[model samples]
Target: MDINRVSARNVHQAHYELIVIGSGFGSTFFLDEALKHITGRALVIEWGDYQPWAWQVEAQSNSPIAPESTYKNSGNKPWNTTIALGGGTNCWYAQTPRLHPNDFKTRALYGVGHDWPLGYDDLEPYYCRAEQIMSISGDPDIGKVLPRSQPYPQPPHKGTSVDALMKAAMPDHHFICPTARPRMATANRSACCANARCSQCPVNAKFTAENGFPSLFSHPKVDVCLKSEVRTLEYSGNQISGATIASEGGEYKVFGDVFVLGANAIQSPAILLRSDIDYGQTGRGLHEQVGANVEVFLEGLKSLDGSTITTGYNYYFADGDFRRNRASCLVSFENRWWPFGLRKERGRWDEMLSLSVVVEDLPNPDNRVTIDPQSGQAVVDYRGESSYAKAGIEHVFDNLDKLLAPLPVESINSRIWRPTESHVQGTLRMGIKDDGSVIDQNMLHHRMRNLVVVGTSSFPSCSPAAPSLTAAALSIRAAELLYS
Candidate 1:
């Protein structure tokens, strides 16, 4: 607790064997595994204070700092995030899906982007470990595509009638999406009650860092400081000395043998840029999936039998030869959501289904994160959305009619662009070359081996599925590879 006191009156200087910034999935999972191999003291610096689940539900807010205040955007679209102690874990939908095997070899397979330094097999065991810790709910058959090493902890959540139709038509492509929202009641969490609201789960069913990963903070060798903003890494040449932190009492520097930056894609790169640690396009190539929502009207089917808020994933468009010409998308079947429409025609009010297509984008350096001269906060200039992703959307438009032909006769209806998937990636990609990437496959900084950057910021490519599970898996792998 004395390390948290940042004033001239405090005579003792703060130092630790390990210093970790941010407490999201990347930080928590990495720490969860790293501490197993490490016996030294670790300090976690969190920018925002923790809010209880009840407070979050009543306030209808995840963090005291709204996402809009954290960054200055050049475009109308915004990046959604929770800036509290738990980070985005306080406000995620809990949809967990693994990246397709082909996603790792984009350059080798489709000649679009650089290949990931590592492959699915390297992270498969860690994926199983992360899934077990989260008690993920998923069907075993998904292994047909993802090649899982272990079965999910809980059985899959049931799908809606519409999902059944798609799975029946495309058996290999459609399956229940793995989710952190428990299917069976646990001592710490209740089973998901089809609450329909996921971001701010009204029932507190989703696995949040506060509830799911509480031990990471309470570990005997660990201590956490809230409301402590880390400004930059204090390093000389290739050695990391510590970090400069700004707190209410005063500004001071803290020392550590190792530093792990687990902040989000936007903030992590900003921290690196502020520290003057530019290696391999440090603040460039920032992106996420560009998604579009579609509605389907069925003549005879009645919807709403799904067991969770989001039920199934359609991977038919996620990978294939199409990547040689255009980008691909991952289709998600939205279930039990309120915003999905109802028909006005007599006796046909409940025959509609809502679907969303998430398209992966090729990273563009022109679309980047920079520092605002005045505010010093991150300034996101996102003018260049990949044309490949747009082309993928166009391809979907051309083939959706035929793809949905298996379902009952009705209209394909309208499509609306989603403002943000809230999944910021890239900026500090991992690869074998320091000239093109900031970190290596093990997540060690290309310049400073002691400085490890964990999280989606190290993602080499944008996968259409949510990156939380993958990020967590990568964290576990990084810890075992380095410390074990």
Candidate 2:
């Protein structure tokens, strides 16, 4: 597993068996799987420079917000993402929950959004593979809401004292959250020290693409180019011939047998739109989860002493008969101290607790990303269909007292707003029909045989669960299809 790292200026061999854009979970997982089957060379082009965890920790330590550039959005809602080597995994909190079985058949069951071309059973094996690679630790039995064929690689990470208290208070609700962070030292990475800054794990304990799948970069079959931005796909008829890439030196076309777009929800569609290949479905069905934050003063109770950020989950409201009318939500207990800027007394600050409620938003085709004709920037015209989400939020607020009855509650501040657009999905969605979807069940473009799109963009619908694990699983499945 020794990869050939090359600069755009030195790349004499332009042809590759596979060309994957972006080094995130979408492309990296696919590269790891594709390397085993394909003997031919594969190229992974990343737009951003490689930033190690050590460097990120030092750079983002003092700042409340991490240093990162975002894609322009005319709608004022910015996409919260990172373009580094590991992509969003470098900045994510690593809460990996498999989508519930019902999530795949949302159209059939709820009669709202389009159903996924493939079902949960189709992705279960790949999910296991991704979990093993990521060293996911969690109580498999606790994920009863989402059935799985196999157990997790490791047992659930130990919850903080506050989590225990919450569990004790709400015995009926499941509180454990499946996470990618290692419970104990394994591989070369250290165990989670509960530093409460998972966004920039100083010890590299979190399973980012760089640490989790090092072989993808080190493999002899793979050649990764950093700071190479793939501008557009060069297509002849029904196949993508090459990719026009913009590097620091100059623009160059890199030919490949097959091209995969793993550049995330925003950039992926932007690339497709820029290529002038209108599938009629590109940049459509854009949506994100409806998120609300509940700040409370836990009298005499101490919090923010746990591992990184999230510690517990209340899945009581994730799904139910309520899906017929509105979206369902999952409540997460935040284990990080608030009032991020000002210095606070350690003893007094421990009394603060934050509860995050994430409600599922139905995919609306009208709420989409369109490239500005003049500026050439991706403009997200997202008018959220939040009535359903609002209903769900109201339900959560009504049950707050009942859920936290056993615990001491002093003051509560509940605020609901549109999500930070972190979990972008449904732009280049996957479905059974070519007329409705950008890609098919295999994530291959409907019109272009050699073009495949991966990542959250291929998600038919956004569920309440965090989408990274599912995205990784989908990427692996697509890789298997491509190699076979």
Candidate 3:
């Protein structure tokens, strides 16, 4: 937690078998893999720190963007993204849901983006590995999708008081199904205690890089240097020789035989562009599966009272909309306040269970993440219609109303203009043609042989399910291709 001491002054002397940028789920997962598999010198360059200054903490306390950037809201405006040791995974709401099988081939069905080179079968093993790594727990059969190879490593957390109330009101509605079990830091190394202040898990049940990857910091094969911002790539010809890192004290060049960019969709592509390493469409064709919480307020009920769970009912999987049966999922207590613990301390348990319907958006080029020319900073240009998004909202609301006929539910509101996307994909899209993609199926850069690009950003289509598990799945594949 010593943020001020880990300076970027020793980049020139640093050596690694692999150099990873950013500290998000994608980057952290890959680094975890390298630590186990590679066995040589590996270093992760994280832009942020675990403990921000008092001012930084105050600035990032209430952001809708929540886990990603400490300084920004979940909107079109630019904000200071976090540079913590754990990255955004530190503050993320660990709700891991698998992508539907059809999500892998959206192009064949809807002609939107290119189909993923791989599919569910290809990722299933890694998905299981990732779930185990994160210590996921859930019911075996909560939905139509998610065929697990093994049982969850842990048991489901108990729901809160508000969750219990919702279950009582809508006894038949599968508003809250078996949600994903969160991975957190714990002394027992088993499951989380699932306490009220679980977000700040005294025992780490939530899977965070802060707690997960830090265990590897002592390994000689792994070196995690925080506060190290990669300025540019040091290349010999087209291959990356090393990278220039700028920190609080000074800057130096670090070299690696192989380089992997796992800086999420925006920062990853931005680093490539800044390195003057263009593989055709460097940052175009970005696709983020935008999400909005369509909340329905039920009259005359206390807040839902149930144990915390990541299980959700995928009504969309059966709905025949946009060529896919699934249109959205029901998150019965997503915005519900009691389980979050803060509202409970304030004695606000009289609230009703707020249902959140999550829907997937049609991919369009108009919605993208790009580097702003004037400010030279990353900017998100989201221009999809809120009306189309509401269609899914309406769809979910109608079903909930029918199921709980006399539950006195009224007034549905869809409020996610610029969605908080943990599943960011597409920017350096993968495809057959070099003119359109930055990397090929093997995750090799179209232009550079030694350089590899992994993570959700390479996915041609943004899948409906969350991308963290899938991204880890892809990283498992990428490591093989890189080391082979």
Best by TM-score: 1
* Candidate 3 structure quality by residue, lDDT tens digits, 184-234: 335424354444343344444566654555565556666667766776787
Candidate 2 error regions (>4 Å): 1-3, 61-70, 165-172, 299-308, 339-352, 416-421
Better of 1 and 3 by TM-score: 1
- Total backbone clashes of model 3? 41
Local accuracy by lDDT, each model: 0.84, 0.79, 0.58
lDDT for model 2, please: 0.79
Q: Give TM per candidate.
A: 0.96, 0.92, 0.79
User: Candidate 3, TM-score vs. the true structure?
Assistant: 0.79
Q: Which regions of candidate 1 deviate over 4 angstroms?
A: 1-12
- Can you write out model 2's per-residue Cα lDDT over 1-484, one digit (the tens) per residue? 2446788766644899989898777888887888889879888898877776667889873223332333555566656767767788888888988888888887788776778889989999999999998988876656566677788887777666667877776655665678888887787678887776788887888888778876668777788888788878889899999888888879888899988899888889988998997795899888878787787777787767665467788877877667878887888887765433212557676777788888888888888878778756677787865687778888888888876766678767555554473888889999866558989999899989899898898998878788999999998999998778
lDDT ranking from best candidate downward: 1, 2, 3
Kindly give the stretch of ten consecutive residues in candidate 3 with the minimal lDDT sum.
Answer: 337-346
lDDT of 1 at 383: 82
Q: What digit string (tens of lDDT, one per residue) describes model 1 on residues 262-325?
A: 8788888888888888888888889998988888888899877788988888878878888977
* Shift of residue 317 alpha carbon in model 3, Å: 5.3
Off by over 4 Å in 3: 1-7, 52-81, 158-203, 236-238, 294-303, 309-311, 317-321, 324-332, 338-351, 369-376, 379-390, 397-423
